[model samples]
Target chain A: MEWLYVLMPIAGVKIFWPGLIILGVGVGIIGGFFGMGGAWMVTPGLNILGFPMAFAIGTDIAHMAGKSLISTMRHGKFGNVDYKLGMIMLIGTVVGFEIGAQMIMWLERLGSVEKVVRYLYVVLLALIAWMVFHDINVKKKKEAKMVAAGGDAKDAVGVEWHKTFHAIKIPPMMHFNEAGIYCSMWLPVFVSFLTGWLAGILGIGGGLIRMPSLIYIVGCPTHVAVGTDLFEVAISGVYGAGTYTYKGRTELVAAVIMLVGASMGAQVGAVATKYIKGYGIRYAFGLAVIGCIVSIVLKLVAKAQNIPILDDASTAVVLATVSSLSLYILLRFIAGCKKELAEIAAKG
Target chain B: MKTRFIKLFSWCLFACLALPEFAHAAAAKVSNIVIVADTRKFSGWEAWWTNLYNESHLYFALLTMALIPTVGVIFGTFADFLMGFIGIDLKSRGDVGH
Candidate 1:
C-alpha cells in the first residue's frame, strides 16, 4: 500500500497514484461527455484523496486545461464547437472571472465563505436539475404530439427561449453558423459574463452553469453548447492554471499523470457524443446534477453537524457517481459504434 | 427592449451581489500564502522540480501552462490514430441533430 502512494512534488502529499488516474479518466470522460470541466467532483475528490485544498484546485485546473483542450479539439472535429460564439464570449468571460476572483477575498472577510458557498451550490444545482428535467419533460410531450401528427420528433426541442431572444432585434445580430443560430451578440456575451462571475464566486469552473445556459439562454444545440463551452472552459482553464501555479499552488506532476488518462478519456467522451444526441445528453446531465446535489448536501450536513462520517459519505457518493456514469457512457458508446459499423458493413 | 432588459437585469444582479457587506471584504487575503516543497531526499528531475517551486513561481507556472497544451496535442493525435485504427471515422463530422 505504501508503494502504491506517490508524492506530489509541490503539494508534498503522498497520494494514492491510482486514485489520481481514476479521477483523471472519470472526470475526463464525464467532462467530455457533458461538455463541462467536471471540477465539481474533481476538486473535492482530490481533497479526499489527500491533497491540500488549494493544491487540489490548482492541480485540477492545470490538468483540466489540458484535458479540455483535447476534448475541444475532438469536438471541433465533429463540428460541434461554435468557435465564433466561443470567441465572442471570451472577453466577457475573462472580465467576469477576474471580478469574481477579486470579490472572493472580499467575500472571505465578510465571513463564512464555506457555508455560503455550499448553500449557493445547493441552490444552483437544484435549479439546474429542475431545468434539465423540465426541458426533458417538455420535449417528451412535444415528441408525443409530433408522433401523433405524423411528423418526426428527431429534432424537437422543449425550450424555445432562443426564439424570443432572437426576436429582440438588437443591433449587431451575429450568426453562429456551427450552432445554427443568428441572434444578438449581447446574449452570449451577457450569459458568459454572468456564468463566469458565478463560477468565480463559487470557486468552480463555469461549465456546469455555462452548458445549460448555452442551451436554454444562448439558444445553442446540445452538442454545440457542449463543444463551445469546452472551448471556453479550456481557455479559462489555462488562465486559472497560470494564476494558481504563480501563486504556488499547482502540482504539475499530478496534473501530468492525470492528463495521461484524461487524453483517452476525453476522446471516448467526445466520441460518445456522436452517438448520444440532444435529449439524451440533457437527461444524463440532469441526473449528474442530482448526484452532485446529494453529495454537496451531505457535506454541508457534515460541516454543520461536525460529523466526519458524513464527510466521508459525501466523497464516496461523488466518486461512485462519477465511476458509474463513466461506465454507462462507455457501454453506450461501444454499442452505438458497433451498430454504426455493422450498418456500414451491410451496405457494402 | 434589449437595453431595458439588460439594465433591469444588471441592476438586480448588482444589488444581490452587494448583499454581503461590501466594505467588510477589504481585509481578506487569499493570495498571501505560499508553500515550498522539501527537496532534501530527491535528486535530478525531482530536485529541479522542487527547486523551481522554491525559487521562481512565475517560470514554474509558465512551464506548466506550456507543458499541458503540448502534452494535450500529442495525446490527442495519438488518440485520433487509435480511433481511426478501430474503424471509427476520424474525419467525418458527427450527425448530432443539435
Candidate 2:
C-alpha cells in the first residue's frame, strides 16, 4: 500500500498512485464511449483522491490528450471518424469561442457573473438530458410500431432530422464519406460554431455539446459523432495541456500512470459502442447528464451555504456516479466481446 | 488530393497551436487565475524539469504535448496486442460505415 503512493514534485504533493490509475480508467471508458474529454467527471474524482486543485485540470487535460488519441485510433478502425468534418468544424469552433469569450468579458465588467454562469451550466445540462431522453423514447416507440406492423425493427429510421439537414442546398454542399452525410458545407460550420459558443460560455471542453450537435444537427451517426468528437478532443486536449504545462501546473508523472489505465479502458469503451445501437449510447449518455446536473446542483448549494462538507459530499456523489457508470460500461463491453466472439466461432 | 489534405492539415495545426496563446494573452489581463507553485522550492528531477520549463515554455509545452499522445499510442498498440492474444480483433470487430 505504501508503495502505491507517488510524489508529484512539481505540484508538491503525494498522491495514491492506484487511485489516479483507477480514475483514469473510469474517465477513459466514459471519454472513449461518449467522445468527450469527460473533464467534469475527472475534476471531482481527483479532488476526492486528494490531488491538488491547482494541478487537477492540467493533469486531466494532459491525460485526456493521450486518452483521446487511443480512443480515436480504435474508433477510426471501426470507420467511426470523419476527419474532414472535424477539420471544418475546428475552423468554426475557433471563431465562435473567441466571440463567446469576448461576450463573457463584457458581462463580467457589468457585474460578478459567477452565479449566472453556474446557473447557465445547470440549465444547459438539464436541457441536454431532457432532449436525449426524449429522443431515445421516440426512437423506442418508433421501433415498437415498426415491429407491430410486421416490419423489421432494425430497418426503422427513428429520427428524421437528417432529411431537413440534407434538404438545405446552400452551395457548395459537402459530402463526408465516413459519416455518410452529404449536406450544405455551412451545416457543420454553423453547428460547430454554435456548440463552440456554448462551450466558451460554459468554460468546458465543448466535447459534450459538440458530440450531440454532430448527431442531431450535422446529421452524423451516433458512433461517428463519438469518434469525431474524440478526434477533436485529442487536438484540443493537446492545446489545453500545453497551456497548463506552460503555466507549470501539469504533473506529467501522474498523467503517464493514468495513460496506462486509459489505454485498456478506451479499447473496451470504444468496442462496446460497436455492440450497442446509437440510441443505446444516447440513453447511457443522458444518464450521465443527469449525474452531472446533480453534481452541479450540489456544488451550487454548497457554495450558497458555505458548507465545506457539502462540497466534499458533492465530489463524493460525482465519484460514485461516474465509477458506477464506468463499471456498467465495462461490463457491457465484456458481454459484447463474448457475444461477438461466439458469432465469429459460429461462422467458422 | 493528398497534397491538398496535407496543406489543410498544416493550417489547422497552426490554428490549434496559436489560439490558446491568443486566449491566454487576453485572459491574463482580465482573469484572476494565476500559477500558484514556486519553482525555487523544487529539487531533483522536479527542479531540472522546472528550470527547463521556465527557460523555454513553448518548447517544453510542445514536448509535453507530443509526449502524451505518443505514450497513449504506444499503450494503445500494446492493448491491441494483448486483446489480439485473447482472439479479439479491435481493428475489424463490428466495423460499419466508413
Candidate 3:
C-alpha cells in the first residue's frame, strides 16, 4: 500500500501513483482519438486525485501539450490536417482567447465565476450532444433518400450547415485542399475566434468545440476536423503550459509521469483513427461529452448540498468514464492493427 | 444579402473585441496568489526539484517546457518503432478515412 502512493514535490501532496498513470493513459487515448485535450474530465479527475485545483489545470495542460504534439504529427502524416486552415484560424484563436481571459478577470470582481462556468458547461454539453444526435439523424434520412432514389449514399453527410455558411461569399475566398473546402476566409477565422472565446472562459483547449465547428461550420471532413483540432490543441496547450508553469501552478513530476503514459496512448489512439470513420469518431465524442456532463452535474450537486460523498462520487464517475473509453480504444487499436497486418501478409 | 451579413458580422466582431474593455476590472489583474511547496521531508531529487521551484520559478518553468517535449518525442518514436516492427507501417496510415 505504501508503494502505491507517490509524493508530488511541487504540490506537496501524496497521490496514488497508479491514478496518475490511469489519467495519463486515458487522456492520451481520448485526446488522440477525439482530436481534443481531455481537460473537461482531467481537471476534476486530478482534484479527486489530491492535486490542488490550480495544479490540476496546469499539469493537465502541460501533459496535453506533449500528448497533442504526437497526435498532430500522426494525423499530419495521414493527410488529415489542413495546415492552411489551421494557420488561418490561428489569428482569431489568439485574439478571442485574450478577450475571454480578460472577461474572466473582470467577471471575478462581480462574483464567483466558478458557478457560472459550471452552469455554462452543462448548457454547452447539452447543445453539443443534441447537435451530434441531430446530425446523425439527418444523415440517416439523407442516406435513405439517396438509396431510395437509386443512388449511392456512401458520401452522404447529415450535417450540411457548412454548405449554407459557404454561401456567405465574403471576400478572400480560400481553398483548403486537405479538407476539400472552398469558403470565405473569414469563416475559419470567425469560427476559431468563437471557439477560442468559449475555451478561454471554460479554461480548456477548445478541441471538442472546435472539432464540431470545423466539420459542421467550416465544412471539413471528419478526419480533417480531428487532425486540425489536434493541431490547435497543441498550439493552445503550448501557450497554456507555459503560462501556468510561469504562474507557479504546475506540478512537473506529475506532468512528466502523465506525459509519458499519454504519449504511448496517443500513438494507439491516432493509429486507431485509420480504422474508424468520421461518424464513428463523432459517436465516441458524443459519449465522452455526456460523461463530462454527468461528472459536472455531480460536482455541482455536491457543492450545493455540501455533500463530501457526492464530490468523491463525481471523481469516481470521471475516472470510470475515462478508463472505460481508453480501454475500448486500446482494444480497437489492437484489433485494427492485427487485421491490417493479416491483409498485408495475404498480399505478399 | 452578402453586404448585410458582412456588416452584421463585422459589428458583432467589433463588439466582442471591445466588450473586454467595458468590464474595467476594478483591479487591473487577478490577485497574485503564490504557493510554497512543503519540502521539509523531501530528499535527493525531490528536494532539488522543490528547491528549484522555491528558488526560481522561471527556471522551473523553463525546465518543464524542455522536459515535456523531449520525453514526448522520445516516447513517440519508440512507440512508432514498436508498431512498425509489428507490421503497421509508421510512415503511411493503412486505412486512412476508414
Span of ten consecutive residues with least summed lDDT in model 1 chain A:
A90-99
For candidate 2, write residues A245-301 as lDDT tens digits: 777677788888888888678877887787777878888899888888888898899
| TM-score between candidate 1 chain A and the true chain A | 0.95
Candidate 3, residues A1-348: lDDT per residue as tens digits? 999989889888889988887788888998889999888778877877888875877898899989998889988988888988997787787777667877887798898999999899799988998898898888889999999999998877787888999999999999899999899999999999998788778766678789888988898888889999998888667656766787788898899888888988887888888877788888888888888888889999999999989888878888888888888888888888888889999999
- Which has the better TM-score: candidate 2, or candidate 3? 2
Q: How accurately is candidate 3 docked according to DockQ?
A: 0.30
Specify the poorest-scoring 10-residue window by lDDT in model 3 chain A.
A235-244
Q: Order the candidates by TM-score, highest first — what do you get?
A: 2, 1, 3
Docking class of 1: acceptable
How close to the true structure is residue A84 of candidate 1, measured as C-alpha lDDT?
82
Candidate with the larger lDDT of 1 and 2: 1
Provide per-model DockQ scores.
0.32, 0.47, 0.30
What is the full ranking by DockQ, best candidate first?
2, 1, 3
B1-98: candidate 2 lDDT, tens digit per residue: 99999998998787867576435633533334544444777778878876676676677678788899888999877877877787786765463321
RMSD of each: 6.5, 2.6, 6.2
Tens-digit lDDT string for candidate 1 (B45-69): 9999899889999899899989998
Ranking the candidates on lDDT from highest down gives 1, 3, 2
* Best-fitting candidate, scored by TM-score: 2
Model 2 regions more than 4 Å off: B1-6, B9-47, B54-56, B93-98
